[model samples]
Structure formats: C-alpha cells, structure tokens
Target: MPLFVKDFSWEQTDKVVFITVPLKGVKASNVDIFSSEEYLKVSFPPYLFECFLYDTVEDTDSVAQVGNGTVVFKVLKKEPGKWPQLQSDVIDNKEAMKVKRTEAFAKAEEKLKEQSKLKAEQKRANEQYALKEIMKAEEEERNRIERVKQSERQKATEELEKWKEEQRLAAEKEKERLMEERRKEEAAEREARKEQEKILKRQTRGKKANIFEQNAEGAPKREVGKISVSFTHRQFPTPERESVKPKEEEWLKKQAEARRIVELEDENLSEEEKNPMWLRDKGNEFFKAGNLEAAINAYSHALRLNHTLHSCYSNRAACHLKMRNFFKCIEDCTRALELLVPPVPQNADSRVKCHVRKGTAFCQLEMYVEGLQDYEAALKIDPNNQQIKDDAEKIRHLIQTETVE
Candidate 1:
C-alpha cells in the first residue's frame, strides 16, 4: 500500500528519454531502481514510482543518477521517433499495469543473475591465472638455484684437487731435503771416525816410547783409595717417588662406572662394542645407509656414554634435517656447537657444519635474518667455502624482496 509518486517529470528526444523523480527526504542508499524495455520502477520505502512507457526503450543502455533528494534517468529509445506521452494508456487499467510490473521485475532479476554469474567466472579465472604465475616463478627460481649449486660444487672440487696436487709436490720436496741432510750427516760422521783412528794410532806409538818411564812412575803410585757411599734417609725402606695414588684410584673408579653403565644399558653389546668410539662408528654406518632411526639411536647411545662427543650431535642434526624435523635439527646443532668450544683448528670443520645446518633449519622456518647470521658465522670459519657464500647471498636477496613487497 505504498503511495504513488505523481509529481515526477519526463522529456523525450528522437533517440533518448529523460526522467527525473523528486525523492522528497529519502536517502539515496534506501532507493531501489529497476527497469525493463517497456517498464521502469523506483521504490523508496513508503513511496513508489513506475511507468509503462508509451513506446519500447533500450533498458540495457539506460543510466540513473541519484543525488540531492532526486533521481534522474536517461533511457534510450528503440526507434528514433517522438512519443506522444511519457506513460502508456494502460496506466489507468490497474489489472494490465500489475501484470506488466510482475513481468518486468522477473526480467530484471534474470538479467542481474546472468551479470553476477559472468562476474564470478571472470574473478575465478583471474585467481587461477595468478596462481599459475606464482608457481611458474617458483619453478624458475628453483632451477636457477640448482644450476648455481652445480657450478659451485664443480668449482670447489677443482680447487680441492689443485690443493692436493700442491701438497703432494711440497711433500716430495721436503722428503728429498730430509734425505740429503741425512746423507751429509752420515758422511761427516765417517770422516770423524777415520780422524779418531789416526789420532789413536799416534797416541799408541807415543805411549810405547814412554813405557819404561810410565812403569817407573806407576810403581811409585800404587796407593789404594777407600770410597764412602750414603743412602737417602727414610723411615720406611722404600724407594722415593711422586705420589699419584689418589689420581690412579679416581681413574679406576671412572672406568668402573663407565663399564657398569654400558653393561646395564645393553647386555647384547660385546666388550669391544661397548666402547663409545665403536658406537659412534656404528652410527656413521647407519647414517650412510639411510637408516635414520638406527643412526639416531646409535648416536644417542654414544652421547650417553660420552656427553662431550660433538660429532655425534652434529651428525644427529644432519639426520634430523633430512627427516624435515627442523626444530630438532636446530637443537642438535646448538648442542654440538656448545660442545665445540675454543674454536681450535681440530674442531673448525665441525663448527662450520653445525652453523650451516642450524642456518638451514632457520631458513626452512622462514627466519631468514637468523639464518643469514648463522651462514655468515660459518663463512667466517671457512672463508673459502663458495657454497656457503652463495647460499647466504640468496637469503639476503629473499629478505630484500620480502622487504620491498
């Protein structure tokens, strides 16, 4: 039971029609406008305005502007001709106008559904295209990284071979120098022995000449001498020695404890296999064979026997990394690094491995900055490692890309 808006105005040209409706105090957001080839309707809560046009118009090309408490519509006519009136004569026939309104509303709803469907299809297509582009970019990046890795590995291998050749040559030179020095020393010793023999012969001849005089002097010097010897004073009749009794007892105690622990942990282990070094070797074999669980168990057993085994922790971290347990890998790497203290040449390689492994885990977790720091630390330890340098540079580029985005 909405009231009809009767004060609307309209004008027409040969090819177009203009309609303006006063919205009174109605807001634009509350207005609803719908149009078809022959009918147009505008609803604003209690007010409604509609028209069955005098002639067919192009609703597809129709446009509406709403502002300042008014709505303006510009509709195109199907035929380029003047109209006698804005609305048709059926406006006075309630039944006919009602039927027309229902038909027009249904046509407008169908058109809206088709447009919405088309828009959805277009949006879906765009998203799929974007996804494909992203995947392609990722694939290209992976290929580039693989190529770089292969090149670096080849270069490192060549450098290692050249270094080994240089070492072999230098060792040969050192060996020849040592052999020549030894020969010179042997010749000098032979000459000294010959000279000593000549001196001894000359001395013997002189002694023969002085034999009569010496016998006379010896006869005068036939006196005996007595020598007194004293032993070190001690309350106990035992030889003196530094006291190491307590140290020996402590070492024996630790050995006994280690044996007890090993026996209790695994009765199947033989006496030879109970050693920590044996267990570590077993772990290495298991790791090389790709038995990660067995390797981890072996490494764990070795660590239990000897907690200071940094190599066991480092190797276990490698296993964890292969298993994609990144957090566990980082933990093992950290533990290994802690055990590899003082930064000695003997432990330099182990330190570098731990740093690189931990960095890899960090990068897997998307903590690029932390990963970069660890890689840099590894590079400091092994400055000649081109692989680590390249990896660090890639991470830096990723960080930059993310930051820019």
Candidate 2:
C-alpha cells in the first residue's frame, strides 16, 4: 500500500509529497495506508497535524514507493479507530472520500476551538493574580507610614511630660525662696521698730529733766520794810481863795479863745467836707478793727479815685493775703507795681516797704522766683530792716532747695 501526506500541504501538488508503502505483498483491502483524490482536496483546521487512512489492504514490503504501479482500489465508508491509522491502497471513489474528508475537517476544527478557549481562561487567571499582588503591596506601604507617625507621636508625648515636670519643680523652688525672703524682711522690721521706740523714750526723759532745771533756776525772791507817819491841821484865809480863783479865770479865758479859733476854722470849711485822705484813713480804721473785707473795699475805692495810689493797692494786697486769697493778692500786687513810681533818694524807706509788701504777696501766691527777686531788691535798699532781711533769707533757702531737687 502506498501512503500520502495526511495533513494537506499548500506547497505539495495534489496533497502528496513523497509516497511510500510499508508492505509489498498485501492485498489492497488489507493494506494499512491508502489515499483518495477527494481526501487530498479537503481543508483541515490549523490544529490538526495528521489524518488516518483505514479499511485498506495490507502490504508485505518494508516500504513501497508511491506512483510506481497501478492498483485498483475501492474506498470504504468507515470511520478510522485512531488518527494516523494505515489504509491498504489508493482509491478514486470521490463521494466516499469526500465524506471522510469532511468528518476529519470537523474534528480538527473542534480541537482548535477547545485550545483557543483554554488559552483565554489562562490569560484571565494571570491578570487576576497580578491585581491581587498590587493590592497587597499598597496595603503594606500604608501600614508602614502609619507606624512611623505613631512613633513620632509617642516621642512628642514623652517630651511634653518631661518639660511639664521640670516646670513644676522650678515653680516649687521659687515659691520657697520668696517665702524665705518675706520671713527675713519681717524679722528685720521688728528689730528696727524696737530700736526706734528706745530712742523716743530717751528723748522724752531728757525733755522732762530740762524743763525741771529751768524752773528751779528762775525762782522769785521776797523782801520786807518798816515806816513812820504824822498828821497836822490848818485854817485857809478868804484872800488866798480869791487869788486862786483869778488864776483859774485866766486859764478859762485862754481855753475860750482856743475854742473860738477852732469854730472859725470849721465855719470856713469847703463844700467837699470829705478829706482827700479819707479812703486811706477809713481803710486803716477797718484794718485796726479786724474787718479785712471792709478794709479791702476801702483800699480798692481809694485806688479807683487815684490809680497812682500804690499804697492803696499794696494795702489791699495785704488784706487779700490775710484772707488767704493768694491769686487776688498776686493781682493786687501786680497792679501796685504798675502804679508805683520810683521814689526819691530820701524816700527809699517807702520804696523798701512797698517792695517788702509785694514780696510777701508773691510768697503767698507761691511765685517763688518773683518773690525772691522782690526780697533781694528790698534788702539792697534797706539791708538793716530785720523783717525784710529774714524774708529774703527764707526765700533764698526755698529757691536753693527747690533747684537742688
């Protein structure tokens, strides 16, 4: 029997490449390999590598060459037991070979379909496995970050606790130090008070002893005297009485003449009976009577009449000072200074008096600088005046002390 290529080959003519027989003396019906023209024309799916040829003759030759001899063959209508089974001879039955070719092609196509399905299933499994691995790696990275953050939080908590403990200890130590300082201060104050009390008691005892000694030294002394007395009586004559009466009449006549002259002067007075110096005299009377308000009014009235009256303003300033109206005193003093004219050489005493009064008003107003200037000017004019000299010294001391401060 001759055998051909079971799978079709596009490059080979009539689906036969190099044919060979496995036996030589076999009948065509008993051969193991055979071929048909219809089988050569069949198309096989790509998965089928070979096909079986069956129900053919057996051969005795070890190998027989194809197309070497003519042999009659009939195709059998039977399915092969297995792929690659042998057939006896080549056949020319186109119908039966066509049916066998169709069955073989259907089997080859079924195997190809099964292989494609298995490959698709394997690809799906591989993708699922890759996805699972990626998810597991992401979870591990997240867990690692959480662990690092937890470690940092623990470190910060420990540090905070340590700082708080240090602060607590520092506060306790400071409190103890302050308490110790307060205790020492209280003890020092108590000792100082005791020393001050002892000094006061010693001073009181010394003052009492001095008073007793002064009284003993200034005591009064007494003296006694004796005297003798005598009495006499006499009668006076009428002629001696007449001589005494005439002397009395002569004294009365001189008094009457004096009275007549004062009457004549009164009758010759002017229409304005009031004196030009009335305001000043009335102000003086009020001052003597201790009526400071009336005295100031009278002095002011005198100034209104004659603005040049420096004495009235100065006297009114004195009254304002006595009433403790220091601002009013300063005003009056200022007015007096504006009205006062420079005095003649012989009237230096009056100028000095005015300056003293103005200085006293300045001191009352607490105008220390002006007050000291006035006192200095008054001392230059009347250095021997004790009151002016004392006032100038006092003002000088006040100015020096204030400047030092």
Candidate 3:
C-alpha cells in the first residue's frame, strides 16, 4: 500500500468522475499519474498511491487540476452515468474481485436507470408532439370543410336565382301561348256566328213574325211585323290573359292516378314485400337518395305498422342529422337508444353508432356537455372501441378548447 494519499474525496458529475487528493507540501512536476485498464497509480516524490478501477475509464480523458492546496484528478467515464464507488477497495484478490463485481453491477444498474429515464422522457415528448400534430390536422380539416360549405352555399344561391329566372321566362312563354289559343277560339266563334247569320238571312229573305190582332169587324185578322236579330254590339273576351303568375299558382285538375294508390292485393308479391320491412327498406332508399321528407313519411308509416321496429328510429335520426334538425335528431336517437338499451338489435355496433351520432348532433348544436356525456356513456357500453375512444377524445378536446375560451 502507498501512503501518498493522505485523504481523498471522490465525486462524480454528469460528464466526469473526480477524485481529489490533498497534498499539503507537494508541488507540481513531482506528481506522476499512471493509468491502465484496471489500475490507476499516482507517484509523488518517493511515495506511490494506487487502486484498482471500479469500472472501465478512458485513460486519455484524465486531467489533473491544482487549485487552493488540493490536487484534483478528473477522469471521464467510458460510459456516461453514476458509479457506486470510484475505485475498488484493494483488500485481497478474492474480496477485491467480489467488490469489483458488485461495483460493476451497480454502475450498470445506474446507467440502465438513466437510460430508462431518458427513454421515458422521450416517449412523453413524442406523445405530446403527436397530439399537437393531430389537433392541428383536425383544425385544418375543419377549416377546409367550412370553406367548402361556404362555397357550396354560394353556388346553391346562384343556382336558385338562375332557376327562378328560367322559370319566369317559361311562365311568360306559357302565358303567351294560352292567350293566343284563347284568341283563336274567340275568332273562330265570331266567324261561325257571322256565317250562321248569313245562312239564316237566305233562309228567310225578309224576317217577320205573325200575331193575331182584333179588327173593326171583330173578325180574325192576321198582322205581321218585321224584326231583325242583330249582334252588332256584342263583344267577345278579346282581353289578354292574366299576367304571368308564379309556378305555385298553376293549378292542375286532380286526375285519378293509379300509382299514387298502392294496391297491396296485387297477386305478384312476396309476403315480406308488403310489410313494415319493405317500408323500412324503402325509407332507407329514400334517405340515401336525399329525399328527407319522403324518408320521414316512409319511416312514419313503418313505425305505425310496427312500433317496435328495430332500426327505423335510428335511421330516421340519421335523416334528421342530414337535415340539420338537431333537436329532432336527438329525440329520435333517444327513442332508438331506449329500444336498443337491452341490445334489442343484438348488434352492439348499432347501439354504439347511435350514441356517437347523437353525441355528434349535440356537438353540432353546441351542447358540449351533453355530447361529452353521450360519448362517455358509449365508451362504457363498448370500452375498447377505437372509434368511440377517438370520438371521446375529440369531445374532450372541444371541451378543453371551449373552457379556454
């Protein structure tokens, strides 16, 4: 053993492990440091201090600094982390090996802990970054949808105006045609009357009627007087047809239409084609075609036939959603949920769909809390459904943003 080290203090930092040996009278140029894979030696003026390394150290990375009556040796660790002890206590070969092994394991564990902490921090940062990116994408999508809807509204307004102008022109043309037809009929009737009068004049050369009158002899006397039936001052309806009216004013006489009345008794039919199922299917078709009013009517008819029909109410709720009838959508969804609470349709997915749709409708109406509640309830029904989770996440974000506002 070397007695050169009077007392030593060892410390470690993020980048380097430092061991300070206090030498009271020793000066520079007299200290020599020797480094090896498993040993470190310091010789200062006829005395030598040496110890076996606890773990691997970079020999070239060693530096010696002298300040304030102390000599400090800072050696960079081969791996960046903590060490349980700076060097193994050189007691004996077997005991020394045991200490070194334990120290090595301790160093390895400390490095592993640091690496684990770093990985955790990185994972959290990555999650935050991904969340930010998702929120940004959602915002962009919403903005794009708003722009598209605005453009569509403007286009629809322009198209409506153009249609109105076209309808006005068509009505005017139709009015003119009716007026000409009326004029032709009146002229024909007048011409026919004139020909009839001419024929009547030829039939009776001088028109007269006879009446019996009393004479002075009180005998029968025949008296005649001329009379003419003239239509000189008669006028036909040559006035113009009424001004062009709106299309709504055009009345068509109701004629019997067979298609308007369905005869269910027709021979060529299946049993399933005449019932609520058929009506429900028909309503679905109407809904898909964008005939919301007809869909509503068909759904109503089906409900009347079978009040407990499984999906009609839900389908009707979808119709209301498309119509922007948010309240009605909520109502229909509630009804469907009531029917589907015990898993009536035996399709949990259908129930989940209803919940999500109703929640979305509530969100559309700006009832955020209700929407959030719905989403949470749906998650309880189907905890692992990814779509429901996503919807719930969206609702939570909306709530958070609204709270910020």
Candidate 4:
C-alpha cells in the first residue's frame, strides 16, 4: 500500500483549477499522472494521490508539468463556477474513490484506442493519396515522352521523303543528260560514216572499175563444208559421307518430332495465357494478394516466354526476398539488372530497384561490403532518394558497430 499524498494544495478560479503537488524527494522521472473528466490521479513509487472532482472538468484541455521535485496541473473546468470543496462527495469513502479511479483508467484506455485507430486511418489515406499522385505524374511523363518520340519520328519521315524526292530528281536529270549525249554522239557517227562512204566512192570510181569487175565474178566459186557440234557432259561433285546416312536421318527425325511436341504444347495454351505481359500482370496481382508462391510461378512462366523481361525477374526477386531465399533474390536481381541494359532513363527506376534488392540480400547474408557497394550504385542512379541515403547510412553504422565489436 502506498502512502496517500495529502499535503498537495489547489486553487480555483471561475474557469480553471490549479493543483500543485510536491514530490517530497522523489525524482520527476518516477511520477505518473492520469486525468479524466471528473477524476485525477498522481502516482509515484510509495506515494499516491487521488481526487474525485466536485464537477466535471475539460480533461482534453488540461495540462500537467513535472519538474523541480513538484507536479503542477492547470486543469480547465467544464462550467465556469466555484466549487464548494476540492474533493467530491466520496472524498472520505476509499472504496468509492477506488471504483471511480478504475472507471477513469478504462475510459482513458478506450479514448487512446480510438485516437490510435483514427491516426492509422488517416495515415493510410495519406499514403493512398501520395501513391495516386506519383502514378499520375509517371503517366504524364510517359505521355510527354511518347509525344516527343512521335514528333521526332514524323520529322525523320519528312526528311526521308525530301531526300527521296531529291534523289529521284537527280536520277531523272542524269538520265536526260545521258540521252542527250548519246543522241549527239549518234548524229556525229552518222555524219562520219557518210563522209567515209563518199571517200570510198571517189576512190572506187577512179581505180576499182576494171580490177573489181573480173574479181567479183571469180570470187563466187568456193566450196561450203559442214561442221559437227557436240557438248561436254557435266556432273556435280558429291560431298563426302563421313557418317552413316540412316543414323543421321533418324537423328533429324527425332529432332523434328521434339519440335512438333513443343509446338503442340504451345498450341494448347490460350493467347492470353501465352502472352508474357499477361503473365506478368497476373504475377503482380498474386503479389498484391500476398501469394508469394503463385507470384513466383507466374513470374517464372513469364520469364520462360520472354527471357528478356527485366520486370519479371525483378518482381520474382521481390518474392524471393520476402520468402527469405536471399541467394535466389540476389540471382534474380542480378539477372534483372543484366536485362536492363544500356541504362536509359526509362529503366533507371528498375535498375535502382534491382540494385537495392540485391543490396538487401547481401546485407541479410552478412556481406556488408558487397551490400554497401550495391547501395552506393543505387544512390548514383537515384541521387535524390533520401530513403536510400538513410538506409545506406544505417548499413554503414551497422558495419562500423560490428567491426568494433
């Protein structure tokens, strides 16, 4: 049983009541205070104080200060008035006061629970709003990038059309120039041939009249001989048969059969089920539903269909991390990072996620040095991320502490 604190003094105004209680030698840290609409309690080890007020006071507006071997309360009154006495009607009844104290404690706990629930709801609402804003911003950014790409593509197409038109005009001009040059050459050749015929006619008129007349008659008597034509036979050189033909044919047949089986299996799947993107979306749904195994299976199927899908690897790595398969997490994160090649702005966030996930796996495996390197790499990609910076700082601190130990 605690000694009752009876030396406390209090004063009352029309709207407020001030109570001062001395610690008598107890430290301020050891004091505990509770207040309600009509009850007040101050407790320290070996000391206890209780008051059932004459009227209800505004507990929400009440304030208590503890320091310097004393506790003072500035309690607001519910109604502006002076009371007949500080204590309530049950001041001398110990059992009644005890019951009042218990009820007040229960009410305080209930109020605290209500406040906590309200705060949690508010926090969830705020987080949802923030997520919405982030998604909206990302969508707008993608739209802007697409519009810019469209504009650039249109400009390139126009430039290509212009280049083709220029080439066509140049080709036409070259054809016309070549044709004109050929016509000029042909006319020159005709004139040269006419000149040569005139020269021949002049020479023949002077000298060949007597000599060619007898020679033309004499040259007609010559014999015609027949010649036989024959073609050489052509044959293709065959390649050397290094292996047995029957066994090679059998191997080829087996390969074809295996290929047919694979095709048949693929044909059994629906178009949506066959799509890697669809499987990835399904995996995301499973992940949100907290079905890690289902999510991993979905991601694995998606990866099989499209091995280059970095998001699937990254998502599967997340599932592995949650399942505490740290080695698998590291492997998936590494594969995802490899697939996210060239490090463009579009894949920057994915790269950062992979690096951070791998870093987390490394840290979980107590490979702090490797984990720190990955975290630093992630920081380089997302320098403005305060959360990553804080995490890196924590890892560094942990490493230092471990080293010292």
Candidate 5:
C-alpha cells in the first residue's frame, strides 16, 4: 500500500536540502539512501521508503551518512531559494499529519514554559507578601512596647513627684511639732517659777530673819518629780501607733500566751513582740507571705535574741533562696547546720535539709565540687532519700560535663 518511506524527515534550505531517517537495528553497510530534485528513496532491512521531491535538484552533489542509529542525507538545491514542500507527490495524508503534530507540540511546549514562569512569579509574590506581614507585625509590637514604656515612665515620674510632696509636708509637720514642744517647755518653766515665788512669799510672811535662818539651817528637802528627756528613732507600740494593726496585736498576744510557760526574766531580748520563738514564727509567716525584707528582719531579730535557734536560720535560708541570694542562703544554711551539730536521729531531717539547701545554693553559684560534697553529705545522713540521691547524681553529671556553658 506504500511506495515511499513511512518514517522520514525532510527539510530544504536556500542552498541545500536535508533528509533524516532512522536505521535502528540496521548496520550502515546494510542501509542505502538516494535522492534527486524530484525523488527521495531509502532502503534498510524490513523497511523501504521512496518519495518524490517538490523541486528538481542536482543529484550529483547529494551525500548520505549513517551515525547514532540515524541516516542523514544532504543534497544541493537546484536553486538558491526556499522550497514550499518536501515532496512533489503526496500519499495517505502523511504531510498534513506531520505538519499538524509539529505545530501542536510546539504550541504545547510554549504554553508549558509560560505556565512555569507564571508560577515562579506567583511564588515570589507570595513570599514577598508574607515577609511584609511579618515585618508589619514586628513593627507594631515594637510600637506597642514603646508606648507601654512611655506610659510606665510617666506613671513613675508622677509617683516620684507625689512622694516628694509627701516628704515636704512631713518635714513641715515635724518643724511645727518641734516648735510646739519648745512652747510647752517654756510654759512648764513659767509654772515652776510661779510656784517658787509663792513659796518665797510664804517664807517672807513668817519673818525675814526666820527665812534667812531656815535657809542657813538647810532644812530637810522634800523629793520633787524628775523630768526625763530622751531622743530615739525606735518606735514603741501603743494604742495610737498607726503601724500596729489589730490583727498583728492579736497575733502577738497569741504568741505571748503560747510562750507563757517559758521564763520571761530575760529583759534584754527585744523584737516586734514577745519571745525569740515568737519572732521565729513571725519570720516564718512573713516568708510564707513572700515578704522577703520583713522575713529577713524578723529572722535577724530572732537570731539576735537567741543565736542557737536553727529553725529561724533554715527558714531565712529558704527565703534567701527564693530571692536568689545564693551566698546568703549558703551562709544561713551553714549556720543552721552548725547549730544542729552532732546530728541525732530526731534532728537528722533538719541536718539533711540544711545540707541540701547549701548544695542547691552551691550549684546555683557554679561551685560544682562543693555542691557535690554537700549533696553527698545529705545522702550519707539519709541513705533512703531519693531526692538527695538524684541531686548528687545530677551534680556528678554536671561536674563531668567538660563545659557547663
């Protein structure tokens, strides 16, 4: 049904022409190719093709070569201009099919390239939009923080001004109080002078000679009330004291009743109220309430009264730990441990806690060896304590770490 090649390509240039044909599974010696101005032919095993050219050409200048499983033919054109068609005669609509398929493929490839470019552009646009949104959010956050900082600074400034005014008013009141005290003192001196004059007039009524005789005799003197003056910044609690609330008074009363059995003969001990144990309890309450300064004051007072009280030291150490006063915590814990010397079975828990507290402080201070030693001591005191065991293990691991950073 076919007299020409079914699988072949042909194109004509201004000065030359070309025809390509596949020769898969065929050797170069086994294939044959020939062409003319009006005719093209190819021969290989099991395949034969022959077709007529569109124009007449010189057949002598034609050449054929086979390489990479393809056979190529080059021929000189009879004229130096373009050719409208590859073949002079057509069969089975092959020419129309080839032209349509080539154009469709080229159009499809162009469309694909355009789609890829558009997708790339859209991706880049989305990325830019995301970056812009992130930057906007960050800028807004910075603005919000700046506004808050400004507000806080303004509030602080107003508070400082108010405190200064209060200080000024207090100073004025103190000056007025001192002036009133001076007036009262002058009035008292005047009253004393009037009494002395009345006494002298009574003596003069007796007799001028008798007054001089009584004065010379130096009569037994009667005791008069003495005036005492003292100055102090210390505040003593009374009914009119503003700092002493009713609840605090009640707590002091309760503490006093609790310590009623203890001897109150030690008059030198002084604190907020009552005994050293009461002060210790007060410090513990302050610690529970998160008042570090008040707790420290109460504990210091208790220690001043009785330096052997270990509970106050330990509790104060706990407060110091919360405040991140690492060295202070260690010092208090050490003192508590010292006061709990010769650890008995009943005091083992206290000793263990002190050691663990000191160890934790050491760890926070980056003293790994000291921390480990304290933890080990705690473990020795309470071998069954899992917490101490874990703490010691962790410290050992930390020490073994070449760099804690």
Candidate 6:
C-alpha cells in the first residue's frame, strides 16, 4: 500500500512538499509511518493532493485514525515553453538545497570576519605611520632650533671681536697722543734750560774773572819789550814753530797789555762806568789767559747788557762749543746770526767764525744735514782752511750714511 503525506514539512530540509498516495489494500496498522505506531494508509489518485493524517490509540492495541488535516502546498504554474517535470525524489532535492544554503551562509560569515581583521590591522599601521611622522617633525624642529642658536653664538662672537679691535685701536691712539705731548714738553724744557744757563753765566762772570786772575800767577810768563805775557803752550809743536814764535810773542804782549788796560780801566771807573764794555774787556783778558769759563761768563754778562750784541753771542757760543755744550752753543750762535747786519762785509771774519762755530756745534748735536750746510758755507769763505774742509767732509759722510739707512 502506498500512502501520501500532504503539506509535509521536513525539519532537516526546511521545505514544503506535495505528496501523492496510492492504495493497494494493505493493513494500516502494519504500516511504518510517523513514530513506531499503528498508521492508517490513505491513498489518492494521480493528481497532486495536499493533506495530512493523524492517528490516536485508545489502548495498546486499539487505534483511531484522523485524516485530511488543514495544511496546504501551493504548486507554481509552468510557463508555456516550460515542461512541468516532477522530481522523482523531492525530499532528496530539498535536502541538497538546504545543505547548499547552509554552506553559502557559513562562507559569507567567514569572509566578513576576514574583512574586519584586515581593517583593524590597517588602522594600527596608519597610527604607527602617523607616530613616525610626528617624531620626524619634532626632530626637525629641534635641529632648527640648534642651528639658530649656533648662528646667534657665531654672530655674538664676531661682534665681541670687533669691539675688542675697536678698543685696542682707541687705546693705541691715546698712547700715541700721550707720547707726542711728552716729546713736545721735553723740547720746551730743554729750551728753557738753555736760557737759564745763559742768565747764570752772566751772573758768574766777575767771579770767574777773579778766579782766572788768581790762577794766572802760576802760569809760565814770557817777557817781550818790557811787557810780561802768559799763555798756554800748544800740545804739539808745529813745523812753523820759528815763524809762529814771533807772532805768538806779539799776540801775548798785546793780550797782557789789554789785560792791564782793562784792570786800570776798572779801577779808575765810577760805579756807573763799570758797565757791559768793562765786562767785555775783562772777558777778553780771561780769554787770552785761556780761561774758557771766565770768558763765557763775561760774554754772557755782555749779552745780558745788550741782547743785540752779536759779538757777545758769538763769543759765548765759542765758549759753549769748547765746553762740548753743543745745544747751548747752537742756541747762542743762532741768536748771534739773527742779530748780524745784512750785507756782511768781506772783511767780517767774525761772522764767518760764527758760522764755522755753529757748524761745529751742529755736528756735535748730530744735526748732520744742518751741520753740513754750515760747514759748506764756512768752506766757501775760507777755501784754504784745512780744518773747515775736514769738518765738511766728515759731516757729508755722516749725512750719506744716515740717508742710506
């Protein structure tokens, strides 16, 4: 007997099915259907039918059956070109379809899980990249600050050096200024000393004259025509000694007479007449006695009496030159030169002597160029004087050496 279960739901397959049953007169209690229970076998025709059956047992052996339960299965209509072919095994087809749906759902769920994991990893990677960029930026900023600091340090150092250089220059300038001022002050002091010496010599002239007179008594005396003369002998005797002796005697006698005349003049003088001329005559007496100090004193006194007296200046200058007082000698000679009359006569040997004296003083002072010029002028006047020529040659040599240096 064939039995049909209509509107049957298969829980495993999850599908609705239409079933057909055919009756072959089999005993319903002997059929295996639903649970292990007595069943009613209801058979249908070849058309599809939708119904269900239930069985109720009153006792272990007695059974009551119910049929045509209210469950329905709707069949989809076929299009005109489609053939409606029924599955030979509908339950198997439904089970396969159910398995495919479960597999597809599981595959979709796995794909979703994989996608979520990828997104999480990407987020973490992005965060790490951002952190790296932040670190790089910070490092760059730190380096920039360091560079700025270095630049500032360099600039500050340069400024400090420049200021130091300026300070050094300023100090050097101040020092040079001070040195120049000192030099000028020293020059002024020297000039003042020379003037003071001149004044002192004038005051001491009479004292020097008395000293020379006292000293003259011990000197060697020669007699010439009732005149007694005293003079210092030359250190080296000259080849012209014989010719020089007569001239020397005459010069000595004249000097002694001049001295006597001066002394007598002083004794006879009223205090008013004992003036600059008297001092000059006394100076001449001392000069002839070879008393340079007294001669200088007397000349200085004469100069004090008349500053315009060129002869006094020249005489004093000669005394200073003998004493190796070159600066004072130059000072007096210069004063005498300034006071000299223009158009100096050809016979004015005193002026020429002053020039020669000045040149000697300049040479001693190491004013070589000026000394050379003075010597040259003296040479022009006294061309035959070997002494003047020798002095000029020496000064010229000095000037040449100085120029080469």
Stretches of candidate 1 exceeding 4 Å from the true structure: 27-29, 78-81, 92-95, 175-405
Clashing pairs in 4: none
Residue-by-residue lDDT tens digits, candidate 5, 1-405: 423356788777798888888875678788776554456667786777666666667766778788988888787887789988776544457886455445545655676798899999999999999999999999999999999867755665575478679999999999999999999999999999899878767755755444234334687434344577975543344434556566776887667654653544356655446567898988888888889989999998777667789988998898888876777899999999989978799999899888898999877766789889999999889999887788788889888884655
Q: List clashing residue pairs in candidate 6.
A: none
lDDT of 1 by residue, 245-302 (tens): 5666677778877786756576776875667788899999999999999999998888
**On TM-score, who's better, 3 or 6?**
3
Error of 2 at 271 (Å): 7.4
Best by TM-score: 1
Q: lDDT values of the candidates?
A: 0.87, 0.59, 0.74, 0.87, 0.77, 0.61
Regions of model 5 farther than 4 Å from truth: 1-272, 403-405
lDDT of 6 by residue, 278-361 (tens): 777778888778899999888776655555678788888888877767768878888877887673565357767888899887
By summed lDDT, the worst window of 10 consecutive residues in model 4 runs over 232-241
List candidate 6 segments past 4 Å from native: 1-273
Model 3 TM: 0.34
> Total clashes, candidate 3?
0
lDDT value for model 2: 0.59
Per-model tally of clashing residue pairs: 0, 22, 0, 0, 6, 0
| Candidate 4, 1-405: lDDT as tens digits | 999999999999999999998888998889999899989888998999888988999999999999988899999988999988988998878899788888898999999999999999999999999999999999999999999867755665565478679999999999999999999999998997788778767767766454335445566333233466985432323333445667666777677756754664566688888778999999999999999999999999887766779999999999999987777999999999988989999999999999999999878766788899999999999999999999999999999999999
Worst 10 residues of 2 by lDDT: 40-49
- Model 3's alpha-carbon lDDT is 0.74
- List the candidates' TM-scores in order: 0.46, 0.31, 0.34, 0.45, 0.35, 0.32
